[model samples]
Target: MHPIAKSVPLRLLVLLSMLLAGCLAESEPVEVAGKCGPRDLTPECCLKQNPGQWEQCTGSTEMVETAKTAHSVATRVVAAGVTATVALQPRINSAEHRGAELAVDLLLRVDKAIAQCVRRAEREVNDYHFDGRSPSRELCQQLKVGEQTTWAAYLGLFKHEQAWPCLRKALDELLPKKNYLLHPRFRHDGQTGKWEFLDEQAVKKIVSEQGWKGLTGSIEPDIVILDEKGFIVHVYDLKFPCPETNVATWTRYKNETWKDWSQGDLYKTALGVTPKLVSPREGVVPETK
Candidate 1:
């Protein structure tokens, strides 16, 4: 090789090394679930900090792998456009796999939460020997004094109370793992019957500072799954029907903006994805028109 040509590769290697070093130096320690580790350590640094203890590291392995993959793509970009695309193939595939895994995990968590809440409700009713009557006062001293006289009366309350919080608990745990948004906030446009997603912090700040308000009250979706590009891929709502046997259905909005529009219709129109109903008894069911 010519002297200059040989030196080019050596210089490129040094530049790449310097860039990698700079990245490592700039890496901030990742905090997960209130646990913090040594500052300025990447996942790779964590692995090196404690050999074979990567599982215990605070830095996410997924993040480090993505960073490495991105670096590979950057390096290959100078070689050939096709080479860069080829290098990015794995990352694309990985993202798809991650999304699939997230979907399954999310559904499983929802199912578990539903089962647990339903089981508790059932146990409470059985223990109290509920007579399925609307109680004004405690029928027996055994029954705790409440607005609802019998434990059976409380089942209706359970349907509402357990649905959000139970799913919230499950979804919150999964939020840090993937691109799942719990109770994603959106601004509603009544004139067009469209929803403008409020995901950007800057937009939210602008809204708050400017006192910007939606034409209609905001639509809070139960769960939203975003793709690698941050486009919403799926939407889900938890529905716990009081009877468990009764089919879950979306309620029509009585508000002036939504008028008679069913929630399912609004969600579909706004999100471009069919909203799914997850019930304790039914598992997963498609919204019926």
Candidate 2:
């Protein structure tokens, strides 16, 4: 009936309309898939999911090549909304780009360093104390505990005395003093699991010589990587399992501002980076999808 439709064969017009409909459906609104990899963020999805916060969509890429393409019809399209992907072959010539590269390199090294420290700690603790041998009958008797009980107590102390020091020393050697934060404390906002770092004085004020009574307890990450601007770019937590074969997992807070939340989820939301878990046996567990 239409003039354009009359110009073409009826079957052809119907096929053309069907094709147009399919093309239109492709650009229709969509929700973010929430399937982006841990370290990978799709700009369009981020804009869709977090309406006003566009900054989260950038910075993962060392260098960005702006593609002047059509305006993104919706935020959910991966290639639309905004576009930045890790340059397949990035040239690290600029100082700004260098800092990002270094941060990534340091993180990779830290993963290896943590695994080494934990393994060494286990070996050193066993070698120094009993040469990997169980406590003698006489020693257990002297301690007034059964051998199994004595061993369990020793394993508990092993983490504090051996693993803690070993990990701290290794990190000190690997990370530049100004670039990495060790055991940095954060205060949580009551409404959200989001955390903001506490300055040295603020930390001291809350945790006096007496106790941390009445105040919400702090969340401390084993290590936090700070970029040149001092923004926390990455987080890591050392998990030393006594048995060496146990699965490494994120800690879950039970009370206060961070109640009912897992540490990994909180860190990701607050820092905008997926926290890594390091253990002697697990090395660095792959990031969960």
Candidate 3:
């Protein structure tokens, strides 16, 4: 009886330990939920069910595969825009073809510009999902700057008959909400310097709602971006663009044999233009600050 009493506590303690272990084994691991609006990322359930990502995932194969058709059109528009810029650069000074050149060049530039702008806009829209806000002015300005740079080389190069139409088409494709039903999609990758890919569904919606505005192709986008605190920024003054060199320069030590310069000869010419931003006050032109 004495032994039995003493053993009771020890046995009970062991039994309690076993019970606690069993309880822990039966319990599920915790999962903190993440969301994309009403949609949920639903932890391991979603991760396992979705395959890779909807873009590469196996379960939602149709959604991932839907984008294949749009790639060609996107690439073509980008290529055409770049070609127009290079061709227009030297022709700006030609007298015989001046009018036609400028007109064609400007239209092409506008086309490319708007295309870039739309692509950027689409990217911004995609990011909106993650950012929990519409595209910020900061993002727009950076995007606008890149778009503007890509087409400004031909802004005044020639008069383009199709310029206005191209610009309008480009703007129409963006700005307006297509579905307005689905949460606006968005993503951003600083490494790729590209916003997010516009899903096929979204792209199709835009096209069905607004027809294509293929480039000739190049564009000129007006940019007026303010900093986080609402102050305007001077991207030009803030950045020193590395000048393009078509030739190389050489230097020699007093008594040493001269080594071939890989950077080809180039010379510093007079400061052609010191670009400054001016707030627009007189109609279309901005006053220098």
Candidate 4:
């Protein structure tokens, strides 16, 4: 009928058109093969059906509603300037006030760090799914130095005994699988002045003392590995992101920041072992000599 159609074979033109249609279809968001109902609204089904709205489909309705309500309330509060404060406060302040302000800043940083790690993990899971592999707990074992350091910073902000479990999980996820036993919140007995491996009683006994609290509460190491005989073999300090500086500057910074009772020095001193500093970006484990 047409000049181009006449010039080309009809069968070949039809085949090319079909191939183009197939490519277009493949580029589009894949739709679920079957109908999705409430009872069978699994993540896989929801993702296939809605693409990006899987959360709305798969998340609990009650929990979603609750979250929406809380978000609305938070938005109003933020808008009303109820929690807003000027940053032009007096430079000179009481020691307690300064400490509290520093703690708040650290808490905010920790929250950001945790959020970044969670997002990265979610992306990794998505990639694994795209590669036709099911997400596994092994995904947790792929934490980089930055993630581990952020996790450690987050753990250091909390003083409660219950937070130790979280520390344990973080350590379990980040540490190398070297068959060594891990003690997340390892502490020494104040009475006998002896190191206790995986002992909560020892932690409780020393948590109350002012000196012990000062030593362990705000700056405890993330993990300590012990041999079969319950002796400390390696101490790890998960530090904040260090700036890219010359060797001398970096060395000075480390020396000043990781002085006595800071970093994992307290743990190392108590256990009579040198502590290793783990880089948050590269995951380098260099012993602090």
Top of the candidates by lDDT: 2
For 8-49, candidate 2 gives per-residue lDDT tens digits of 122221222222222112111111122333343344334334
Tens digit of per-residue lDDT, candidate 1, span 49-160? 4533424543445433543443443332121111111111111112234333246766566556645654454434333334433232333212221121223222433333
User: Residue by residue across 116-155, what tens digits does model 3's lDDT show?
Assistant: 4333332332333234233333432231111221111111
| Model 1, TM vs. native | 0.44
Question: In candidate 3, how many clashes are counted?
Answer: 26
TM-score of 3: 0.21
Better of 2 and 4 by TM-score: 2
> In model 3, where do residues sit more than 4 Å from their true spots?
1-60, 71-74, 77-92, 100-289
Clash pairs (backbone) in predicted model 1 = none
Error of 1 at 208 (Å): 7.3
TM-score, one value per model: 0.44, 0.52, 0.21, 0.31
Task: Identify the superior model by lDDT, candidate 1 or candidate 4.
Answer: 1
Give me the displacement of residue 6 in model 4, in angstroms: 60
Instruction: After superposing candidate 2 on the true structure, give the runs of residues whose Cα lies further than 4 Å from its correct spot.
Output: 1-105, 133-157, 160-169, 191-194, 208-210, 214-217
